[model samples]
Target: MTDKLLNHRAEGSTTAPPLLLGPSLGTSTVLWDTVAPELSATHRVVRWDLPGHGGSAADLIGPGATVGDLAVLVLALADALGIERFAYAGVSLGGAVGLHLAVHHPERVSALAAICSSAHFGGSQPWEKRAALVRREGLAGLAESANSRWFTPGFTVPELVADHRDADPGAYAACCDALAAFDLRDRLPDITVPTLLVAGREDPATPPAHLREIADAVPGSALVEIPGASHLAPAQCPQAVLIALRAHFSGGAKHGMEVRRQVLGDVHVDRAQARQTPFTARFQDFISRYAWGEIWTDPTLTRRERSMITLTALVAHGHYDELAMHVRAARRNGLTPEEIGAVLLQTAVYCGVPAANSAFATAQRVLAEEAEGTGG
Candidate 1:
């Protein structure tokens, strides 16, 4: 543990789980401005400036630096803030720092999201050239092209361009040197924490294929490609990045179980878990993470609305066995008996009377059981 080496801003309650947001090279903490504030509602977010960018001291790293050096600095900042462990998300070079942490310091990271980043950054020859260019002529030329490199055509963030232009030439060049040396392709399999890779569909820097490669190698890791986004996705399309981050860091199996119990009741979920076997373990996980965790937990639709949609879908598909179970779930989601009937009745026209008739019988039986359970 060391004193903070990076300039950073912390938000959210001290009791909340900490989440560190990292920035791309030549950009400052401003790169995270659009997303961090909202993320702080649930996470104690600490977005830091890279060496020589924003408020961090330009002397933090010199020429020939490595991403490991940056990782250590990030750890120092975490220690200074009294954060023993945290979830991590970053863009580009910042994302690379997160991958490094997950590989070398797994205990420190709870989860990870790498956006518009890569496993090796295309072998580093280009980075070496960029380093030489920055050291010789400064960042003016690069800053002028920042918009083209960091975003899609006609989309730009003036502050980020200025950050690039204003970054210390020596330090920026040193970061480029670090990029030249970074290559984590071999270590990708060693990452055990839940990982997520978000790619910009139009990004010329780290394209979707780069993130896909990571997804295929890191066990259980997921990938999300944002259409119409470029290199700096958080700035260009913060909502998509936020959704991905929230889902990735949403506690996975544990949170899924919580939502599962809430929707289906404790008895059902407990019985399901108690019956889980080695052969059925993966299926159980898929239900929890995919159905309960991802779909059921999405806030876009209220649980009541979801119940209605679910009941209708179940009837339409003739899943009467499952429909009986969800009829109870619909009640738990606050749908009255009549409301559930209405949904099933709507299915009569669309799903045919045969399917709706069976659905009605199942719903009636489940409702009777519920009535008996509570003296209704």
Candidate 2:
């Protein structure tokens, strides 16, 4: 059943981890144009069109087709692409599909970001009405109102409107039917993948509260709200959406290496790597894989926040040698000299003046040396 119900476009290097992107029911891969390219720089991004939308065929969708059926089509697409395990991010209906994958095929999904979507799309009556209207009047029946729901006022993208207008009425109606029967609220806790829920502040369709419900249900899931955007937040607020997605998807060893070098400086990282001996090789690998790759690369907190936290902890624990190295890293992560001083001052009261005093002296020496190196 998966021969061609979905139309897929793959980008990025073959060696990179596969990241599957799903578009909203009425939209196509164009929905991810702004976000996918940037993510492709680190991940192999594969964006696909929903059946009957964009270049995909509507023949697979029949009367009373369920979201599960749509989810199966996505799995088939992944199978066809030879993707065994991958990360997923989807918008609206696309997000619902990702949720389905995480719940049903947990082994296949590494992480998920469900943007402007909900576990259950309210009651079925509204969806039934939409399905009937589109089925009776064709795609033209819902084009204007649908497009309006997609974006905030004065932020329309003509390409998105065109994509909505060009959708096949039958397929769109089938998707509406899929949405009507979709109810994953009770199953939310079953989703074990590291998940992120994103909402647009102004989205009336699936409001922030809708996404919040899912976020509350899914354990260990995080929620992010985008300001000044509507249901199609990815298109309306690409940068914010991209930042959230990158943080979720960029936790691999390769990306961790890049981020580690960026924060710690290439020279310092290279020196540490060069110092790795057979006896210390395993410890180096562990820190690189766990600390830098997994924890440090997380996007939920900025590098600056991590830097400040790392410096404070070092001073509190009297880890002066590591503290000195991190002082240099903190500077690279945008912590000003004044900010570093303030951290030490605050630590002085809680961790003892002696500890803070030594930290200050070490920080001063590192800062002065850096100043001389940079001709400051």
Best by TM-score: 1
Clashes of 1: 0
lDDT of 2 by residue, 11-128 (tens): 9998889999999877888889898898888789999898888899988787798888988998888888888999999998999999999999999999999999998898899999
Q: For model 1, what is the error of residue 104's alpha carbon versus the real structure, in angstroms, after optimal superposition?
A: 0.6
Instruction: Supply candidate 2's per-residue lDDT for 123.
Output: 82
Error of 1 at 61 (Å): 0.3
Model 1 spans > 4 angstroms off:
1-4, 252-376
What are the lDDT scores of the predictions, listed in order? 0.90, 0.88
For lDDT, the strongest prediction is: 1
Q: RMSD of each candidate?
A: 10.7, 13.4
* Candidate 2, superposed: residue stretches over 4 Å from native: 252-376
Please write out the lDDT profile of model 1 over residues 249-334, one tens digit for every residue: 86656678889999888888888889999899768866886688768887999999999999998888899988988998989899
Q: After superposition, how far is residue 60 of candidate 2 from its true place, in Å?
A: 1.9
